[model samples]
Target: MIKIGTIELDGRAVLAPMAGVTDRAYREICAGFGASYVVSEMVSSKALQFNDKKTGFLMDLGEAERPAGIQLFGDDPAVMAQAAKKAMAYRPDAIDINMGCPVPKVAGNGSGSALMKTPSLCGEIVAAVKEAVPVPVTVKIRKGWDKTSVNAVEIAKICEAAGADAIAVHGRTRDQMYEPPADWEIIRQVKEAVTIPVMGNGDVYTVQDAVRLLNETGCDLVMIGRGALGNPWIFQQINAYLTDSCRILPSPGLYERMSVMVKHIQRLCAYKDERHGMREARKHVGWYLKGMRGAAEFRRRAGTLETMDDLALLVRDIVAANSVAEEAGR
Candidate 1:
């Protein structure tokens, strides 16, 4: 078990927050699949401060997503604190501050990874938010602002001093974005420098990667972001792999994958309306069918889906096509 402040996770694998992807439906899916922890997408602190209804909607957590985290992003300390205070009404198990997003719009505004350039400001924000909320307060940060400014250790030290319960280190600089291989050495350094739990993220695509990260950095937990796309079963597989003497689990077959796609769409539709759900499911289905025998054509057709029936028909056609291909190979 991994403990972040008073929050005790049953496992070490966590679902990292992804905007537009880690919504209530998706968080519930990941949690049900054995993800010990899950976090909401990054919400705008300034927007929340202004009482933006949409921003408020972003913190909505499903009943099953409890022990889940809500992540907030912005540069202003006062705004972040106020947002944290407002977020408590939703009863998140913890509050995470986003300091690692590499998107230009977020970083350009001196938010996200921009906070890395100013350790003092980062500390002030953490301290303010910590005082405003009763739940555990954590921060997610990159390796640094850039190669020339590798200051995660310094910044993490400052956040710890400011009362952050935990720190998640994504092993990349803002300049690298998701390009270059993550420097796990930097994560190791941050872990060594801080007394609080360190969650390691970036480039963890498989259970082995998660295990290796824990062994390599001695981090308290592993956060999977891109790796969980279309693969919520990863959390279960990782848990089994870690505990069962490294037993290799077979990958899900076509039928199982398709069934999950349908379930995911249903959940989306239940959470949102049918129109918006189908629109969003298009991308998720594409992710689910990625690299399949006829995925390109299927995805092209999926983009035109306008209703649940359209999605069902698409899944049927894809399954039939896969069956024909399998028979031909046999």
Candidate 2:
């Protein structure tokens, strides 16, 4: 019974909110795979304050993805509070502040990881948002701005004092971006320092990785980012392992993979219209097709996907290409 405020999550794996990924359709898919919780893509506080329709749509939390949070990224405490208030229209189970984003456009603007430079400001933003929203308030943070300024413990303490319900720590510094190894030790330190639940995020691509992360960091949960791009089943597998006598599940078969990918893309098209959804789905298709037989040629075709019909044909071709290889291999 891991409860983030009033929201009770049955599983331990949470879907980390990615910018372009983790839309409504994808979140539903991840939830169906047993993700304990999911967070919407980061919505700019400033954008929400400006009454941005597109940004509002990004915060939509469907029933299929319950126990989900709407993540907001910004530097100003007052504006963040107002944005969180506005986000409540979407009825999110929680409100998460994005303090870990390292991209220049966000961090460069005194937002995201750049907020870490002023630890007090981070606390201020959390306090304001916590006050403005009725749901639980959580924050996602990194080790530090760089190796020289490691201060995750300090930030976690301040945020806790300012009323953060939980803390999610990404072990890499802003300078590290997504490269290099994540410093799990930093996550352990934060977990040790904070009384609230801590979610360890970074480099968890498999069930074993999730287990090792929880054991090594002593964190309450594991947040999957890139790991869940095309493989949401990791959540179900983790839940099974933890709750069912250490049982391990096999990877999805090729038929299941293609089937799920098609359903995911079809739902995406239905949600955002084919022209837009298919464009965004290109990367998703590439991820789903990864490591398959003739993946290179198939991915090249995936890149040019336009409509649901095109996706159907591509999936057929992919299945045909691999079905023969499987037959020959056996």
Per-prediction TM-score to the true structure, in the order listed: 0.98, 0.99
73: Cα error in model 1, Å: 0.8
**Lowest-sum lDDT 10-residue window in model 2:** 1-10
The digit string of per-residue lDDT tens for model 2 on 28-140 reads 99999999999999999999978888998899889999989999999999999999999999999999999999999999999999999999999999999999989999999
Position 317, candidate 2: lDDT: 88
1-330, model 1: which lDDT tens digit per residue?
A: 778889999888899999899988888888988899899989998888788887877888877877899999999899999999999988899999999999999999999999999999999999999999999999999999998999999999999999999999999999999989888998999999999999999999888899899999999889999999999888888888887888878778999988887888899998888998889888888889887999899989988988999988998899999999999999
Model 2 bad stretches (over 4 Å):
none
Estimate the Cα RMSD of every predicted model relative to the unseen true structure. Answer: 1.0, 0.7
What lDDT is reached at residue 156 by model 1?
Answer: 95
Write out the backbone clash pairs for model 1.
Answer: none
